[model samples]
Target: MAEISGVVERIWRYPVKSTGGERLDTVEVDGRGLAGDRLYAVRDGSGRLGSGKNTRRFRRMDGLLRLGSRLGPRLGAPQLLDPLGSPVEDADAFLRAYLEREDVALAREDAVPHFDQLPVSVLTTATLDWVRAAVPAAVVDERRFRPNILLRTPAGTPPFVEDTWFGREGRVRGGVRLAFVRSSERCAMTGLAQPGLPHAPEILRAITLAHDGRLDALATVARPGRLRVGDAMALA
Candidate 1:
């Protein structure tokens, strides 16, 4: 059994699902999912997969949208809000919603808005270093790829620690099972300049160039029930 050692440095949860979220030292997790992670979303009215695709056209929109957890947890039911913690929902009773509009177009039938299909996205410091070395042009940072788990290695290590397993369950120190998957590709969303964070190759350009124009390699937690800082990960 191979291993990738690291400690949880930070945690982030998107209360509104797709919209941005707040950072926390620690939080609670259950079967439904992370307590505050991706609780709401801006749906496209059809009750299907949604995001800021069209909303990005609006100047006041874009990353301006955010999720707030002040209203307490609603289980799988997420409420809407501005970048700030406020209250919002589907006026039309749809899955997706607009940043500024109360009632927007929604998917015709019943579906749901959510983060990427995976339950949790994990990034490691070692991998970031590899990216920096491969593509010096890209100020490779975590913000570009919003990962739920940020694993910090022992300062110097190889790249893609999670790759130890092509496709298998990794037993994190805390005994959590993370079914490693193929690397996650980059997109325009990565290029979006963060609010206060410095700029970087949010586009998958750096990742692509580094991996032969292939934006692959990202770790995800499968049964994220017992993940915590200081959890050492190993291929199961």
Candidate 2:
């Protein structure tokens, strides 16, 4: 029998890399990840991936974090939205203006997945609460971490419990199974300001000094299926 550890609280999917993602009531998981997650990314003129973490080309650019991407009615087509939720007709142009770079272009991921670490990442509310307690004044919304699934663990559960999930197999209510691969490493991107959230460098520093620079768990899809908010999660 599997132990019930938590329930799905939210589902998020990033249509474009390094951009604000959409909050979904439900999402489909596959080998790569959530259906349209990280399908597209902004690339530099030299063909390097434009990532907030890739300081070389992006120069630690945080503007990408302010942009959001949503899937249009048609599949595989993502519409770019600004921080204020306004649609951008020419996404590349708007991104160029926002980043103040002329060499950047929006491009789709080919062959391999565009995820920085694993296909799927999960974080628990306990960890968020713990981090918030560490830095009381800082905003610690899960958006800063950009996880695909946010699980609400039972009350009084310890923080960073996801770390212990490594090597364990878990099943969602819809029969979707996942194998926790490893603890997700923290990056500078977490310190960048996004939309209404103010920049909080202390959050990353606390994670580094106390949590070993990791806060969440990365997982691989063992069984492709749909997952919805409020779904029960069981681990064996």
Best-fitting candidate, scored by TM-score: 2
Model 2 score (lDDT): 0.87
Each candidate structure's TM-score, on Cα atoms with residue i matched to residue i, is 0.69, 0.95
Candidate 1 overall Cα lDDT vs. reference?
A: 0.55
Q: Give the per-residue lDDT digits (tens) of candidate 2, residues 1-236.
A: 79998999999999988999999998878877789898988888776776777644343556888889998545467899998989999998988999889998788888756777788999999998998899999987899899999999999999999978999988988879989999878888888989888989999999999988998889999999999999989998
Tell me the number of clashing residue pairs for each predicted model: 22, 0
Cα shift from native, residue 141, model 1 (Å):
3.0
Candidate 1 ranges beyond 4 A from true positions: 2-4, 31-33, 48-61, 64-102, 105-113, 132-140, 198-203, 212-224
Best by lDDT: 2
For model 1, residues 62-125, the per-residue Cα lDDT tens digits are 5433333322544445444544345655524322343445444322213432545555677778
Report, for every candidate in turn, its global Cα lDDT versus the true structure: 0.55, 0.87
